[model samples]
Target chain A: MRFTILFSISLLLTGSRGFAQQRFVLEQSSISFHSDGVIEDIAATNTNVSSIFDASKGEIAYLLNMKDFQFPKKLMQVHFNEKYVESEKYPRASFEGKIVGFDPAVEGLQQVNAVGRMTIHGVTKDVQFPGTVERKGGMLAMKANFILKLQDYAIKVPQIVWQNIAQQVEVTVDFNYRAQ
Target chain B: MMRRILPFVFLLPLLAHAQGDLLDELNKTKPGTDYTIATFKGTRLVNGHTIETKQAGTLEFIFAHRFGPLDGGVYEMFGLDEAFVRLGLDYGITDNLSVSIGRNSADKIMDSYVKYKALSQRSGQKSFPFTLTALGGVAYSISPRRDDEPEGFETVDRLAYTGQLLLARKFSPRLSLQLMPTFIHKNAVSKTVERNDHVALGVGGRLKLTRSVALTTEYYYRLDPPDNDVLEAQTLSPRYNSLGFGIDIETGGHVFQLVLTNTTSLTERTFITQTQGDFFDGKIHLGFNVTRTFQLKKQERR
Candidate 1:
């Protein structure tokens, strides 16, 4: 009888561990801008996501080939190589942040903060964003929302499009990381 | 008399022969030698040019897909939507030269022309990093016309030509713009009045509104008096040539265009026609074009 009880407990522990391991990736991740009078939006998306951990201290990151963050159609794709992001010169945009007050034991759901440095268009800024850390089954899901201002990142929104584009752009980041 | 006359006649024949040979050589060479074939993909469409692309030797399936269906509805009555589909193939005979043949969707008009990259914005990759410029071939429309027209009317049914120049620059990741200067020539004006060919300046651009959607607009201005210059004789007041405005929403292989154009003619030539009641009264056209790219058979490479 004792052997049966111990075996059951061990099985539960293994099941929880599997749920805790999570990995989420966005095939097309982008932040867009829209405003009055003019209808113009810009989206920058490339493979940009990183692994997350609980209990143990680990870093999470998001990367984007700033050069690859294409504009509208082929126009952006062609001139993109030479003009804007200067992909040939400055290859990538990245962010490195670690989860704070993160604990896997508490279970359920809890609000946490991720402190990190985000580099965009070659400029980096320190940011502290609030996110919900979810522990479900054996998976970990992190969802956060933050505002990113173009001027802050030194991304000069052109005057021609000044009226169309907003000075401050809103960004949302959601990641689900599973155990490898 | 015999010797002198013989010598004169022989010389005349020789001169004619020489002239004929020169003419023949000129005919063999494509027109617009000095101009570059300034054809990039039309900014109106997402893919760029309307010309069908060919790879290897066979027709590339992707190229075939570049051209959408041949749609002719009642809109053709007012010449509102009279377009066939044209896929042009350009060949580079030399590094600095290329020639192209394009078929129009309306009337199946075929255009053959040559372009020269006289100068490129990207010279050796470093000269002008921000701006690109090119001067090239003028496009000519060559479609067979009916020999006879109904009685009592003038026929403006002849091949027309246009010289186009393309210039583009990117200000940043979110903004980019292009300018095209086009000169259009027509043999005869509408039956209403007499006028010369039309010269127009076009400005177009693509702004990334979102990752998948873009705000696209183009404006055409006749450097000379608009077609309305002829209209004044009949209407007391002349009306300006049609102005075009459109937006392109692209997702995957599909492109949907919401346009507010005074004229519905898609081709550059047809739109140049001076017609009334074609102007937009807020009644816009919603056009959607979807292109599917596929790999062609190994033997189909062109």
Candidate 2:
């Protein structure tokens, strides 16, 4: 009976330690999107995205204000918020998901995939994308590049400006996270 | 059984808080207040200025035209034969400050002005209700000579100065209103018959019809009308209040404004004090303004 109790205690301790969630916060990050239209090429970047990372459970969450996106041309920024995003009605875009194939003990650099629901313009969809995650010393950095189809999220572009904006946009996300 | 139950107890807390903790971290920081943007389609509502100003390091090129009164009859081709043009360049030094220089063909006049945005309207945590801008402008007549000059128009006497306060409110995405309290000073005027100073109140409104189109209107009423003797001696058509109607069309980086107004002159110096037409009468003029904006500096998101 003593041996059974010892085994139970040891299993419970190991399970608790493995399942414990370790919180990490975004230190510095950049999220950018590029649209290669037939007539014009447009791009915007955002640095004010709020995010939290869980290294043990390999989970991630991101929340960003649509108006936070910055463009080289101020008019484009206004059009993005007013006509495209309708930011007044839906001011936020968010993503919450899990990162697979990330092993903290293995450290170094590893290839991983993030599976999550990305919400934009008040529309949400399931997305799975590949990324590179590197753990160096005390910080973990993630870099990802993916192509997003606007129609998939119901972000429609009027026919008049069809040549001004592309139907598919390439989005790049880079983030450095540190333990909280 | 004890080992299986013990492991579940430890794992339950981790699974339950997975979504909750991340959500809490995000809710901790809400976005700052949202400032109102694109209150009016263009910088000019109709004949007068609007609360709109160019963003920092942006340059705008304006080409405008005003034709003679529609009542000029067929010989004038319904006024299209007589077209006065104005070319202007406006530059934004900052998001809230801008300066412009322009020359109008009507009186061979040169105009230079500065505008400052004092307050912005915002909604959210600490909100503001209205937008305000202060504008000061000076115009000079470069004409060699005119039969009816304000004292033969000497170098200094050709100058006129104007000051205005633009107050505007966007009641909704579709409706916006503005009120302008204007003051003008002329370097010289007919002795006692015409005062050197004039005061007027202008009211304007814009109704957005679509994402790319809007309707705008403005009227300026003079508080002190010059005496009849000043008008008759100057050989001028009786001075009347300025009234205008405009349609704004926006595409890509260009803004086109179609105007119908009783005020023929484009410069505030003459339009505010020496308007010749009456909207009630058939003295309306057709005009148009087209502006294109270019970004001079890169504003990258950091």
Candidate 3:
């Protein structure tokens, strides 16, 4: 009976330790987008990005508050939130993805492909992008850049201001994560 | 007994893995709160002020025009031939404080005012049901006194002051309502029986017709009605409270309002207390206001 209890306790401890090794929390993250239109170039950045990764399972997810995006022009920011993005109705944009061939034990940088579903403006679509992940000094740094078509997300631009906004928006994300 | 013990031990890690779902954990973190935006698209809804204000470090240039009463018919080109123009600039000193200056052609009046936001409605961690703002203004009549006056009017007599408490709430995504209690003080009255102090209550609402267009209406009721016996004895028309309805259309950086109102003046002191046209008498003027905003300062990085 004593040997059975000791074996069970060891199994519980190892299981919890292994689970802890799989999860990582984002310590710092930034997501930015840029668009070139006929009239001008528009860009904005959001630093308040939250993300988590399970290295063993090769799973990752990100959450970004739409209102956190800041534009150089205050009026443009208002229009982005009120007219274009309608952030009040959909406050957050998110992504859930699996990183191909992810390994936490690897010590150096590795380029990989990510397959994901991104949700914006209450619309979701499957997407694939290339990214780089580097493991150094017990930390993980991930970076990705991709292009998004606004129409695919059901975001409509009125005819009057059509020339002021580009149909394709370039998005970039960078995250530095620490083991949980 | 050994088989049962081994199965229970294996299930423990599976349970831990299920609990470790990253997306589920992200969702569990408190969601960032969202505040209502564009409660009213423009600063003014019809004849009264709306709760909307410019963001900090932004400036708005406004051009407003009011035409003659529609009763003039085709002879006056349906009131389009005669026009009163008002040019104004509003600057946001801070997110919650703003100042504005305007010049109106009706009385050739120059007006300046300050607006302060006391409270804002929000949801989530800190929630408020309504937004409250306070506004104060003074207008100077630049027009010369009437030639028939027995004595020359003093400069102090040409000054008018107005104070208003504006309360608003966004009841839904497409509807917002506001209540304004106003006070006006004029140093001199046009008629002998007219008092220098007046109080009024104003109600306004905006209903979204589409994503880019909204319908707005406002009405002011005089709490202390003026008793102008001397003016009435001279066959002069009695003053009526201002009433207006309008539509707001928002483009990229501009908001345009097309309005029909019973008052020809754009300043609160004149429109709320000194309106001469009666709505029931078909004495309504057609007007339009255009606002263009510019960002004067670059946003600092966080």
Candidate 4:
């Protein structure tokens, strides 16, 4: 009877340990967006990103500072943060989602789906996109490409420069995470 | 023994699920700092200065024009027939420091100034209620000295200096206000004036009417009015405080301003102490200014 209790306690401890060890922290990440306007092309990239992945529960989260995005033109950068994003009022954009088929024990690259809520410019909306998760050398790398509608987030573009901005924007995220 | 082990096994996955609240953990690590932006679109608020400054490594080109008094009627084509132009360039040496140079056609005066931001309004760890900036400038008249001036006038007599302390606050996303305490000193005055030093207080505000448009107004009150006796004896016209009202429109890389003002001079030294036109008498000139910015620094690839 004593041996049975000891064996169960050991199993419980190992189970909790395995779950805790599955948490991963992002080592490097990049987020970029592109929009094709009638009069011009708008593009920006933000490399300062923070994110976490939990393979044990198929959970992931990402946070990006809006002011950190770099544009080819300084004035455009100012307009993006001031007029479009209103970064002062809404400083950060974030996402919280679950990987459809994430497994810590799985090896190699696996295509998966992510479904969650994305918050930007003080507005939140449901989003779903296809992604890939690669597990190699005891680390996980995630890459995703998606499209977002500016109107959905309540980002208003005035009629004066209507042709200078696009209705839809393409966003791509790449993150490589290591065990916490 | 089986009962105890069964309960522990059931709680294991629940505990693992709770551990997946990674977002909460990330939130805790994020620095709590928020800095306000776009307090005002440009550095100038009509005829007065604001606390706004250019970002590091940026260059701005400005073209300003003011026409004759609108009261001139159709003969003057509603003030469009005669134009006084000021062309300027400003460069940001650092995020908080900038330098500008301009030449005004009204007096054929060359102007240069250096501006430094002393404090910025923000919340969280570093919180301040208002922004503060220091501005100092000099204007040198390129026009020949008047023959009516007293003898022994040197070249330095054509120089004037200006200093101002600007305080501003972004009260809301749509409203911003500023106060300017200004001082101007002229090396030589027209013999009638008793003193060359002039002090003034200026107030300015901006109200956003739309996402890309704002209504701006400013007024400067002279504290030390020129000697009335000297003014009436030697001057044909009387001087009044400067007043301006305008609208600002912003595009991607450009800002355009349309204004009406009683002052034809573009620099602080001339406008603060030498405004002879009065708005109440319909002596206001129609004006507009265009500003374009360029990024001079190359961004590093990460």
How far is each candidate from the true structure, as Cα RMSD in Å? Answer: 26.4, 5.6, 3.1, 4.3
Q: Write the per-residue lDDT of candidate 1 for residues A6-116, one digit (tens) a residue.
A: 556655655554344333333333433222325545443333333334334435666544443323333334333333344544555566667787776666788999888
Candidate 4 residue B10 C-alpha distance from true site, Å: 17
Clash pairs detected, candidate 4: none
Clashing residue pairs found in predicted model 3: none
Off by over 4 Å in 3: A1-20, B1-16, B145-152, B228-230
Q: Best candidate per DockQ, number? A: 3
Error of 3 at B267 (Å): 0.6
TM-score of 2: 0.88
Q: Write the per-residue lDDT of candidate 3 for residues A1-180, one digit (tens) a residue.
A: 766676777677766775565678899889999998788788999988889888887899998888889898878887788788888888889999899866777888999888989999999999999999999856899999999999999999875655779888999988999987
Candidate 2's residue-wise lDDT over A87-122, tens digit each? 877888888898899987677889999999899889
Q: Which ten residues in a row have the lowest lDDT in candidate 1 chain A?
A: A28-37
lDDT of 4 by residue, B111-226 (tens): 99899999898877678888899999999998775775457877898899999999889998899999999999999877566478889999999999986899999999999788
- C-alpha DockQ for predicted model 3: 0.56
DockQ, each predicted model = 0.01, 0.36, 0.56, 0.39
Over the stretch B84-175, how does candidate 3's per-residue lDDT look in tens digits?
A: 98999999998789999999999899999899888898888778888898999999998775663348678888899999999999898789
TM-score of chain A of 2: 0.87
Q: Candidate 3 local accuracy as lDDT?
A: 0.87
Per-model TM-score of chain A alone?
0.66, 0.87, 0.90, 0.88
Q: Rank the candidates by TM-score, best first.
A: 3, 4, 2, 1
lDDT of 2 at B135: 95
Q: Assign candidate 1 its CAPRI class.
A: incorrect
Q: Candidates ranked by DockQ, best first?
A: 3, 4, 2, 1
